[model samples]
Target: MQPLTKLLHFGYQQALSSLFPVIIFLTLAGTKAIQVPGLPRYDLILLVCVMAQIIMVKTGLETKDELKVITLFHIFGLVLELYKVHMGSWAYPDFAYSKIAGVPLYSGFMYASVASYMVQAWRRLDLMIVRWPHAYWTIPLGALIYINFFSHHFVYDIRWVLTGALFVIFLRTMVYFTVDHERFKMPLTLSFFLIGFFIWIAENISTLLDGYRYPNQGDTWELVHIGKISSWFLLVVVSFIIVAQLKRVKGEGFANQPVPHAKDRNM
Candidate 1:
């Protein structure tokens, strides 16, 4: 197939794959087959994920680096999610519909795929913010996003939150060292990965500790416990070392150096 056709095909597959989870949840809701906790109506998370993917596919503005960054983020997210489930940080109400391993296939796989699109949207918007740097809008926008998590329909996972926070710190350190030593300038890809890592940790931690778990319904707190938290930390440190080495090898010849008033087409 031609390159353009191939990209279109990939986009279609990604869109359908990402939307599958939302479709399943809606169908389940209609038939009353499964009822998720902390969720009153249909699966809004699934809807948001699907919508984000659709918007990106329609825009046709994605670059190879953006795709690479998003793909890696989702891969890392899935790995962390599998760990969360194994640790019993959270439990699914319906075992029958569980997809991959223990996770609903849609939730485990499709939802993650959808997250890539969401990250891309955030990147595009982030660029605009970087350009405009409006304190008035940024603070309010950040608060709005944070507040939305408290709503009844939105369940925060505590274990993920803690893990995510550590990840963000790790990424921030990576960025600071890279820029400080003139090894490599921070790019959106690196920033997004750091943001995603932190988010994943934060969301899981929030839900596991303070957020709600449903169906089996109990008032007792699960308490924060992650045997693998140290493992994740080690991984982040190792990843930073590797990325730093790679950056050094590429040196100043690497084309992604930061430029003012200019967007990185590679991204």
Candidate 2:
């Protein structure tokens, strides 16, 4: 099948899967036994899933290596998030629903899928930097956008900090290894550092916009602030470097292609 066709198919399949949780939620919501107040309705989950699926399909599925990395990160995040909930590091103000293994399956799946889409988008856009001058700015800009909109909840639910920290560490270590091994060497680590710095700024802005006053509350900064910035920078830089290296390799390979003999070519 054509790549575009495959993308469409994958997207529809994912979109359907995303709605599964909503269906389950609706069934349970009808029951008086399940009390879920002020819970962002399952409709939100459906919307998230639909949007994420569209993004993923548009971007293309993540490469196998990227998928592996994402899976591990998701697993690690899930574990930490579960631990935080258990330890009272954070509490869901709305619904009280625990699924398999004492974690909400729908929430876990949604988060993981979103993370996967992020990785996929990054990979698909990997070559853009080469095509456009100063395209690297998008890395930081996108991070800033996401942090501004999405990070306030982190402050409200500090348990995410533990999971977020773990994710940062995992990403950092992965990027470090990629850089050290010269797998995909980026020439502009400085750009990534800037992006990370901007992410921190965005997060701070998000907090203020949310009317949150945090004076080192829950020690979130103490644990993950610096590390998160560092990791974001490293990940972006390494991703760029890898793309750069891959392009170079591809160019070299094409250049080294053997000339066809006239007789052989005709044959």
Candidate 3:
């Protein structure tokens, strides 16, 4: 009972940090029905997102270290964006002065939003993982997964092999999160799938909000393919590997502050 309650609170914190951008995008998407502004919708949203990021830091909602993680995602996401857009993957369907290579600047923020949730949830929920693989293995696998995203177009896709590798590497790993004085545990690989599934759902919503257009969607709204789950699953793993670089172990003399009675959830 206690663990469930804490998990809910942790989720609430995560939703606040991550979903704010989606909420804003959805709300402003309605403005297309009636507009009085000379600025394009994409530019306006980009401006608001930039301000929102600054405000989060100024208000102390995000720590400097966390901001660094989020910024890293932005840069990495932009690089992926340039490659994906060039390769005729999903695309932005609107006009924006902020456009480059047919990708709007705001597109990168979509990935940063995920990073914000990861860092915020790590702090808010006091997260840790057990039996985490050594960096030697995780880092190389992450690099390969990231590269496959670009190379799949020219070379044959190896995501199937990578998916199997995740299972092998994380087979014994469990993620732990503290909800108040208690802890709960779940398999790390499962969490990867869950996060990926949710991100895929958000992708559908984003496209409906005019975030981007996929090859088959044509100018009309359509549900994003369920098959994309596999892609997002691997992508989420990449995100996790980057975030794990922080080494945010919560207890056993790792964190700066003591987390009282907050041990691994298996108990």
Query: lDDT per prediction?
Result: 0.40, 0.39, 0.79
Q: Is candidate 1 or 2 superior in lDDT?
A: 1
List model 1 lDDT by residue over 1-267, tens digit each: 554664565455445433433443344445354455665322444454446545655675544444554455456555655655665655554344324555543343333443444434333232221222223543343333333323313455344444454344333231211111122234433554553465445435434432224223346645334543443343333333323333334341122323433323322
**Model 2: colliding residue pairs:** 184-242, 185-241, 186-241
The best candidate by TM-score is 3
Candidate 2 segments exceeding 4 Å error? 1-43, 58-72, 96-118, 125-267
Query: How do the residues 1-267 of candidate 2 rate in per-residue lDDT, one tens digit apiece?
Result: 554664565455444433423333343334324434555433344344445445545564435554554455446446645665565544333233434344444345433443453344343323122222232543444344334323444555232443343334333221211111122212233345654575455445433322122344333433225655754554444344334344444452112222232211100
lDDT of 1: 0.40
The lDDT of model 2 is 0.39
Candidate 2 vs 3: which has more TM-score = 3
In the range 126-173, model 3's lDDT, one tens digit per residue, is: 676667778788999999999999989989999999999989998988
Against the hidden reference, what TM-scores do the models get? 0.36, 0.34, 0.89
User: TM-score of model 3 relative to the true fold?
Assistant: 0.89
**Which candidate achieves the best lDDT against the true structure?**
3
